[model samples]
Target: MEISKGQSPHTQPNMRTAKVYTALESLLCVNCKQQQIIQNCESFLKLDAQLRNKRARELKVCLNCLRGGHFLSNCNSRSTYKKCHRKHHTLIHLEVNKANETIPIPQQIVNENTITNTSNQTNSTTNLSSSTLNAQTLLSTAMVKVNDTEHNSHQIRVLLDSAFQSNFVSEGLFVPQISSALPTHTFNRNAIEIPPNIKLADPRFNESRPIDVLLGAGIFWSLLSVGQVKVNQLILQRSKLGWLISGELVNQRFISDQTRASFFSLNELDHKLERFWQVDEFTSNDHILTNDEEYCEEYFRKTTTRDEAGKFIVKIPFKASVHNKLGNSYDVALARLKNLERRFETNPVLQENYIKFMQEYQRLNHMSNIENNNDNAFYLPHHAIIRESSETTKLRVVFDGSCKLETGLSINEAQFTGPTLQNDIFSIIARFRLHQYVFTADVEKMYRMVWVHPEHRRYQRILWRETTNDEICTYELNTVTYGTTSAPYLAIRCLIQIALDNQDYYPLESQVIKEDVEYSQEYSSLPSLDMSQ
Candidate 1:
């Protein structure tokens, strides 16, 4: 209508409700008095709700004009705005220049029953002269006919929904489901089988028929090759659900299908995933904690019990392999002793780190000498290697338990290879991403934090030199030694044990660590290791 109200004077009014003004043509007739006809009609306006409520009993207010004692037609506000068309408001003439516009059904095709029933019940009817419906046609149904080469042509009622990417037919249409995972992502997972067909569908005018299949973007991509093909007078045009084929083709390429994603298959290699990769730079922080006497004493107290003689006996088990390499390992240890002496002479910093390392080793009681050259214990051979990294200036010493004898049997060969104890890299990255802020710290000398049983310490001996010219000395390692096959197992198991032991102090972090460590073991085929302290 020619609505002149406030800032938006030229805006159209809704015609269905009596609360708003009707169009100029609906209000005026050439032979009739327009004022007298509209004065009796009700009016609607965007009035101050409080003002209307205060004057509700006394004032005969015009809701369209927001004035007292008269209706919209009798008010002066309706006469100020101009009309572009004689039959309708100026706002109705604005056109949308889009590729897909809703096309209305012909008069003959629209069910007579719908019009008669609507008019009789609600006094509502469609504009017969108008050739289009609202763009959002909720009842978007279609009749799809399968033109198959191998099977007989069949028809199915389909709903063209663009929300999903894949086409879906009833599970009854396909054979038994395969053992492999289905390609479709919907909750109703079913097999994807191809029917050799050139599908054609007539957008159904009625919403009565139930949809048997859903034609998604997957089906739309196949129709791109057909290009503007027609069925009778219907030509393809884009719609929200997909293309609508009802009018003549305006151009050879009606609309581009760039919105749909192109699908592809993964190669055989891509399907085989071995381990997760991490890109974060991890640095060792082992250099700062040179004094480990306190750490060693705590582990000793937690892991040992006093015997009748008041001696600390380690309660942990020491499992060794059947193969023995004591002889060859001794030879390697002697050679490494010479190399260590030479390095001590050349590098003063190494001498300091070595002195501190030995101090902590002695305080921890990591090894003890055989009494009076006793032959009862196994004299395990050990060799030392220097580790230098960007994280630390001083080189750290690591013992080698893999050195073999003439029989080719070493400590690593004789010990249990232990279960996989580390968490997968992907899970760590995922958890890191979950929190807003993150910090990571490495455990210093993690392997040396755990102790070995006094009996098992006999198999973890090492050779050392107090001075460059001093006689070589032998000491059995009373702690888990690095470079051994079972070392990782023993260390990781101990770490988990310590976490469990202190879980009550930091419940949340401990629970997370425990769950992460146990998750793989529960799902994997590998035998679960006993990690109780």
Candidate 2:
């Protein structure tokens, strides 16, 4: 049976008359949704093939997201994705996109405990994820097998050592003691006081003491205070005992031990005694008055002393006293003139003209002295004298000469040794000369003024004591005496003690004045009168 174009198969005329047409129309019903007529069948078949292809391209259930069937949204597994949002949840599957290429099935999730157990039997077969690994899993997998029954403590220690190698614990961090419950003990908050009488062991004093110890300790303390020795580290140990040193014990050490045990001990005592006696601290004015009184007393005591013959005795011999007095006068005159010259040199206005005048005056004076001595055969007498004291009948002498006469002579060669002696004699003579004062004094017996050391007393011997039958023996120097070659040197040294003690009589410019007289002819013109003449 042939159907017309665009005609419904359901309404087509009969194939074997009307009966065949009815059977074909029943087979392809128009209202039935599942069945299709022969003409519409090609369209329905094309649509079914397209739907099947789209479903094939869609994702299977995610296994992570259990709800959705296609991809994560269509996933049906609920147990696999349980508690996925929790903090400790292990992430197993990871999809990585590289350069716009989709990598399929990148990772698989496995329980850590299961992996640890399975790793014992077959080391290679267990496909375990790394993200779910705990410290136990790492220890079991990398260090030891779970099936191993015995393990060495050293291996565990090595593992622990390596694990903590990168983590640093601060030195100051405190760890609380939480092993047992115990009441905490609180320290006393109040300050404590200490008494003054307490004594402590001074490390300085412990080292050494009367003479040797004292000197040693003095040296040690001096060095320690100045940082030459690290006393803190030497004496202190890193313990509770060191902490005790921070309190009153240490304070007392510095106060009592340091002060009373060191160099300050004698000085402190003297100061205390002076305060107690005077009711006030001693001042410069007090020292000056006391010194003056002492000088007068000493002078009177010496003047009152007499010899066996009942005559007043002088300390300095007459000859030496006169010479020193005259020498001092000349020294003063010369110094005054020299000082004026120095002032002139330093003066801006007078320097040029004054210097020329000074030179000419000096030249003339020098020429006059030479001409008088050479042409007239006039020699200036050495004005010094030696005399015998009436009472003691002992020889005495005086010094009278220009300090200038001693030019080019050293103190060692002339009259003295030691800085103290040189400074003292020069100071004494200089002050008297500068003030234009003449000293009228006598040496009792110049030689006798010095007491020889007992060990050296035998060096002084007299003929009467050695050979004469006379019961009374006189003392005479067998070694160099005060008037001999070495006399000046010894006298100068002896004079230093006097000079330092009696500084008021020995001014500062004594040596300078003597220097000018000895070396500079310019000083010779200054007005000078020697009473020793």
Candidate 3:
């Protein structure tokens, strides 16, 4: 005990017994507010105080331990015992009574069902292993009616689970009421034959009803299982319900279907092949030929286009011809001119068509004459060829850059062939079959669609005139011309650029058409290129 705040350090002893008691009482008086007495060591005074405090505060106590600080729900006790009608945490008879009266036992006895190997009673007291408890906890019950006899049909609870490989019913259901509905095949466990769809009687569930059957995967793929469902006034879509269905059940729901018109048939493929063999009649307005020489001349004056020097030019890389020729041999150019003139004189149809073709070329400004004194200009050998086309009279002009010179160097030899500029043909064909709707169109005058660099244009000089009476004039082809090895590379490269530049304007269409483009070289090795590329 503490003495006094200002007293001596030692406490004085009392000689008399009564005096000792009085002194002890006096010592207790010191710091009375902070003092307490414990009558018995086992009293657990601190615990008593806590209980008292909880009672005073009117706090809840755990039903299991009848102690304060937590509710029955949060209690950590795993012990279970039988009481009124089911398992409980406390013994009713042993609990404290409010009136201190004699406890009277109820007439009804509560039953607890324990899984066992022998007894078939629905509810009976029996020892249960932890595994049994766990299994019971994991099971979910649903009420269902077994199709037995018309007069004996009864509703029972069924376990809906996927653990069992097949569906099963209680063997007790083998009674006359459901015997006729049962199938011959049965499920056996430990030499016992259990009937399908009718098993021995089992306890029913209490939540909604009693459990009677175990529904397994055998019937999961059947109509008994629902593919679509809705609840709580909200519609459930297939995507949401698919999780509940077995993979096999879901897969069985769909079969292969190829009835759509979009499916290309063998006949359609044959037709496509036939079309490939036919002449390509498709023609562009810019390259259309006419029979009037005057009309052709006027068109040339109106539509000729040119590119600014060095601003936007395609680079061409070609190995110099062994001949080392810089310009068209004048003799060769003159010979080609005379050959065309003689053909037109003999074939009137050729003369008229030739005039129209020249006029159109002039209008497009595809060709222009170099200054008479421009000695630096390289002359390109030109020739006219006639071929059978599905459309108008056929005449195509080609530049013969391959002509050999005395030194073994030709125009084509000096130019660059550029890189492999086309896409793989196989890739184009693959994506072509991907879409339901397909569209195809050819670029008119595909090679001439691009302009040559001004510096390079001077090397593409050609000899042309309106008629035999007209003076022979020198002109440079301003665009990529046919018969030039670099034409395909230049045209394809330009096409790729155009598609990339306009992708933002037509994203979907651009992606689809881009797959159709066929380029040359390296393409055959790229087997992974798809529509996106």
Candidate 4:
């Protein structure tokens, strides 16, 4: 790439740089790119510096790659012209663009699921890498305005998935039966520049809103036709749904020569979880979830919703089918309540503490009054675990999730106990050494933060009375019952979700919360406390 003149614009053009740049413009594979280097070699060649630089700048292509729409400072391209390595392309000298100033190419992040699912072995890279996962996974998303049952239009964020086979709607959205905000309720959304006079399908294409509807391949191509406007890597095309943007976005913010991403395989976590939580029997070495755990997740996706107050609402994952609905266990619950009363009569202090606990629950609106009907009812008998040594909670009430009826079926037996979704304590503890600054915080009423579905609340009923003088009252736990098998999974899931949704603003803290935090507490080991802000 050595030229006779570095600053002379009248000098000869580098044929090798031209050929290589042409091969790159053609979108050649790595092998072809290598062949491009082999077939056409670079000798002493030079092009007009001022003429070329002006032309390159006008075309908005980086001088290094001569393809990507960027300045020489942000070029991610490299030259292989017989190992004649210079930051800039051979045709354009260093002084032509920015004198000796090299801008590193920004990196793209691969889908976490892609990396996790492909690799299963423990010895770092044990899992199969289907492809180079260094690139970001881009989804074609748009803010779609759809009319509800009342014919009022509301914007719901949608994902245009051309590879998917079907469409889906999130039950969390307050849409009419037909379908599917906050500090971000109204923010300055990012706007992608579209072609003039082209009516955009969705004006707010860059808002970070929740995905409501997922339109698959069947509905994708049908919406888009021949109309397309290119904006760098992004392609804005007209569609039946609206104008949608596809492809990656370049952000100079993350440009760095090095990207240190710790790819902790989910399989590794599963194995570590097994070792951490000792079991009598060995788990399958395949690093896949059990049938019961898989079923629990599938059920959650199909039935989960969000109420007005922003709490995650979930159904009790009942194993019973349509034909095998179990009868009410009211009589059994009544007998247990009577026995509990007898114990309270002897220990008035215990009863007083328990009553206060239940009162606090009612005050927080964590339980609701439900009609005492025998149909499809399963009352959970409860008792208090009094730890006098404990200062904060001397009397903690716990529901008897395993209380069985005459039919020999208990709530625990009839429902799925979802797999542990939280990172093992061992791993979180191990991460403490990675950073210099660390802090921990306990989440208040963690299990009470998540809500259970109203329809399925009947299955979580309990019997209670202020005193023996008062009549027995039936109440269903509105929040996730603490003793229920699925409670941990549900509550931990919410914590993880909070971290994920806010990662854009609080990346380091969110990472700690999502991957490092325990069930109800956060032990965030950050590089510095400043990052938590």
Reference-based lDDT, each prediction? 0.47, 0.28, 0.48, 0.66
* Candidates arranged by TM-score, highest first: 4, 3, 1, 2
Q: Write down the lDDT that model 2 would get.
A: 0.28
lDDT of 1 by residue, 266-374 (tens): 3333434311222233422122322333343344457665347433344333233354334545555566566556656767766777777776778876656543233
The TM-score of candidate 2 is 0.17
TM-score winner among the candidates? 4
Candidate number achieving the greatest lDDT relative to the actual structure: 4
The parts of candidate 1 lying over 4 Å away from their true place are: 1-328, 343-349, 369-393, 501-506, 515-533
Record all residue pairs in model 1 with backbone atoms less than 3 Å apart, i.e. clashing: 19-44, 44-63, 44-64, 45-63, 321-414, 321-415, 328-405, 366-478, 460-477
RMSD of each: 27.7, 42.0, 32.7, 25.3
TM-score of each: 0.36, 0.17, 0.37, 0.46
lDDT of 3 at 250: 17
Worst 10 residues of 3 by lDDT: 129-138
**Error at 73, model 1, angstroms:** 99
TM-score of 3: 0.37
> Tens digit of lDDT per residue, candidate 2, span 1-533?
45444434665544333222444443452323335542243432243323322322342323343112355444444445243342111222223332333222322232332322233432222332222111111110011112111111111110111222232211212322211110011122121231233222221222111110111222222222211111222221122111111111122212211111111124456667766765343222123324433443344345334346433322221122222222222233233334334444455344444334324423533112111112211111111122445454222221212223334321122222212112233333444466443433333333334443323222222211111232422232322243333344334433333434446665542332332221111121222455323
Residue-wise C-alpha lDDT for candidate 4, range 151-210, written one tens digit per residue: 334568777878889888875454423221111122233434556777665565544455
**TM-score head-to-head 1 vs 3, winner:** 3
